[model samples]
Target: MNPRLLLAIYLAITLAPLGLSAFSGRPARSLWDELASGAGMLAYAIILAEFLLSGRFRSISRRIGMDVTMRFHQLFARSALVFALLHPFLYRAPSKPPYPWDTTRQLTLTDDLSAIASGVAAWLLLTPLVLQAIGRDRLDMRYEVWRLMHGLGAAAVAALLLHHTLAAGRYSADPVLAAVWIGLFAIALASLLSIYLVKPVLKRMRPWVVDSVRPVAARTWEVTLAPRGHGGLRYLAGQFAWLNIGHGPASLFENPFSISSAPAAGNRVAFIIKELGDFTRTVGRIRPGTPAYLDAPHGHLCVAGRDEPGIALIAGGVGIAPLLGILRQLRLDRDPRPTLLAYGNRVAEQIVCRDEIDDLARHHGTRVIHALQEPPPGWTGHSGMLDAAFFRDHLADPGMREWLFVICGPPAMMDAAETALIGLGVPARQIICERFRYD
Candidate 1:
């Protein structure tokens, strides 16, 4: 589906509760009271939607890019936190039991102890939940442990919110509105189950075994996996997968990495991973024939269906992994489109598969440009950062406006390259890119 249409659907789903509340036909309360209720409803709705967004649903992530999906998940979580925090404080009505004359509780807010307790619990849990996610890297915790805590914490908050809303909300007393809340909450739980239980079971049925693990560049290793008893992953050139090696299928020790091997290179899948995280640091030691499981083919950094006249690939350090997949596929298919690769690294040793990249230039007619920040003596390639000036010097061509530009790299390098490419007259829509970080 189109990204814009997906966004529109998201807007509708998030705002549905607000719209439903407006037409509930209840006695109108003060602006503050209504705003408080609306905020609470909006917050809970967004929180429920967060589950689906983070559930790794290919339908959503594949269409909008997993980076964008995860980004929305984080931002929406923060927004829900703000709304939930302000929900109680915004109420202007006095907290008291319902009087005989005021059956609709118009003159007073419900002082139900259990309802308020649940709401308070959810509110308190939300702040630290979002804060921990935003600063997850700084926390002295394992990635798998943090992921477990985050998931359980979110589920608890959702349950508390559901109880608080149905028990205390003015509009939620209505059957239609109450059903909506219940339905959304159920869907959220289902999404969680699908990820943690269903997908793992499916992956367990189709296991893979490690084929090889070897050094590709500085602090980087290439790990290959071949299907144990079935055909392997069917994926595009630049997609990624969550790989769990030498672990149970249901384990949370997996890490996402781009598929560096070409799709045309048979069923054996490969990943180019750098030594960054705990699991990644052990990639060098992963022995051949170790059992592995993959949750794969998730990403939008592919250009298979595009009609661009030419292709330009910009990569930084290990970010060259996915671009290598794309280049290799193009070569295997004997693509006639002009190709250019601008690969930048701090040192020449950091360049992965340098001979293969150069071979693409020598044998396949790819225009390869290498940039080294700390270049060795007598180096001939660019000797500075890949900024706008570097792009203008090497990428200034009349036909480039219609070409497709694919970039994968560090955040700083991707940002600079994007800005430079746009400034150099490359249309933003024609530029395909994906980030590794969500926060």
Candidate 2:
């Protein structure tokens, strides 16, 4: 479904509890007390819904793009945190046992100690959980370790919130709301199990073996994997996967990388990896025949059904991985749409697959423009960043405005390219882009 429909569904799910509680026929409490309950219920709903937004479910991410899905996950998490933090402070009712005559507890908040403790624990844990996510890159921890901690921590908070809500919440005494809370909590836990348990088991059954690992450009390596038994991954071009090589399926060592190989190029898949740190730094040492696993085809960067008269590809540095797959697929299909590639790098040596790129322009009638920040002596390509000026100078044709534009690169460059395309009159629908980082 489209993003608007997805968003509507999300709103319906998250607001269901509040809507139910509002109409549950319970005697109304003080305004502050009602706001407190509403805040707590809304926060819990958003938190549970977060489980499904973890960027693993293809059904949710396929239409919105994984990056956009993740962006939603992060933003909703912060909003939930705010509501949770304010829940306690918003209450105006006294924290005491319900009077014998006040059986409904409308005059006093629930005084159940265990329920109160659970709420406080969840409240405390949530702050650190959100902080760690926000400052993930600044922390001195392995990504794998962080992932495990995050999953366990979130599960703990969810459990605590469920117990606190069922025991202390006024509206939750109603059977329907209680069931809703339990159902949501169960779905959250099930989502965790599917990601951390079920998917690994499936990966083990259909494994891949390393076919080759070789340096392709400055600090970049091209790694290929061939299916050991089953048919290889069937994915559209310009998509990515979480790759785990020389590690068990259960391990958290997997890192996401784009497929540089065309889907039409047999079953073996290729990744263009630029080493920055962590798992990537060891890409060059991976040997042939090592075991590999893929959780793949996760991005909405493909142009499969687009009917634009032409295709424009923009890339910066190793970000060209997915774009290269698009270019190769187009060539293999003998697509008649005119193509343009504007690839940029910091230096000449950083340019990858130079010969193949040249061949596309020389033999396939593609318009290829290369840009370099620091050019060598007598360099003929454009000698500057691929900024607004570069796009304006090379891509101002009115016909180009109607063409489909796909861009992947450094965050800044991608933003500039997107803005420039819009400034040049390209419809937002015709431009496809995905960021590797949500922040």
Candidate 3:
């Protein structure tokens, strides 16, 4: 599950077809002709590989981290789109049917309508697919609807590319190369089946019920869930899950949220949710005992077995959800490692669990520092943004370089904090971040 090993596997899978085709013993074409085929073949394999990089597969995401996995997914999709779009336009030779003299297709491209149509369909579909994903938040569509469209559209593109490759590709005419395309396509389809059919069926056996829902801070609610007929989720403190309320296990009405409560708090699980969407704004209306389902323990933000001498938890607004779980877990276990919490907010009302955080400082020796951009009268704690000045003033201590730094917040704040930390001589690996929005 090492990141390097995963990347090696990916390159092997994506480039294997190209390598095989180059050595297929076919008659050589012009250099541009070979490059054209290489571009298309690599793009096709990358498209099929997209199925496994959906962020649902633990074997891949757990090692690379969801943030990196999703970022790679978006960036790689654009790369494939470029290659596919220019595929047909790259050829310089005249388009013609295969002749009796050239059995290996050294001088001709496939001219059959079936083969050409599939390629054209895939080429046209790849454009909107990438564009929609890039503009998902701005588009006038529900997240679930967009997710469905993405999955179905990707499947359609992959299927068309499969037919196009087997029927029109010169090297793919070989039996060995043809089998590789079919096998990879089958693996791609199977990954979709696992996400939609197989995982949902398993979730039905362990349903959950809404235990409670109440206001925690401005426009934020704390929702709790308990197992209905099974043991509750066995997850680490800083992990997350996809929660579906009043929906069947197979439904797409789910959102990913971090666990705000520690595992030591008992069988129930809690989430700190901010009202940012249509479904989230209805959180206070959800009644206790409503049916729910969870696809959980899906993040790599935990520090359970780390050897670091100290830990630092940095938060910005609702990003404090998972960090609270980590702090609570450390307190419950009577962990003696020194801890520091630097929580930032826009105003006083937005500082959630204020008293509890203060208690951690008083009782557990947690150095809690509150930074407010819009502090009230007579503000004594750190004020202004969590900028380089704030990081230098509080975390310039030599010991901070060795502590594990966990951060989650708005993209801008997270970027500033990371930059400040690195500039202050902290190693990149010592800092951990989890970004939910691939954008």
Best by TM-score: 2
lDDT scores in order: 0.92, 0.94, 0.90
Q: lDDT: which candidate is best?
A: 2
TM-score to true structure, per model: 0.98, 0.99, 0.98
lDDT by residue (tens digit), candidate 3, 360-388: 99999999999999999999998898889
Give the TM-score comparing model 2 with the true structure, all chains together: 0.99
Count backbone overlaps in model 1: 0
- Model 2, span 325-399: residue lDDT tens: 999999999999999999999899999898899999987789999999999999999999999999999999998
Cα RMSD of all models vs. native, in order, equals: 1.0, 0.8, 1.0
Q: What does the lDDT come to for candidate 3?
A: 0.90
- Write candidate 1's Cα lDDT for 1-439 as tens digits: 6878878877887898899988888889899998999899999999998998899888899987999999999899999999888889999999999889987777789999999899999999999999999999899999999999999999999999999999999899889989999999999999999989999999999999999998988998899999998998899999999989999999999988999999999999989999987988788998998999999889999989989999999999889989999999999999999999999999999999998998999999999999999999999999987888899999988789899999999888889999988998888999989996865
Q: What is the lDDT of candidate 1?
A: 0.92
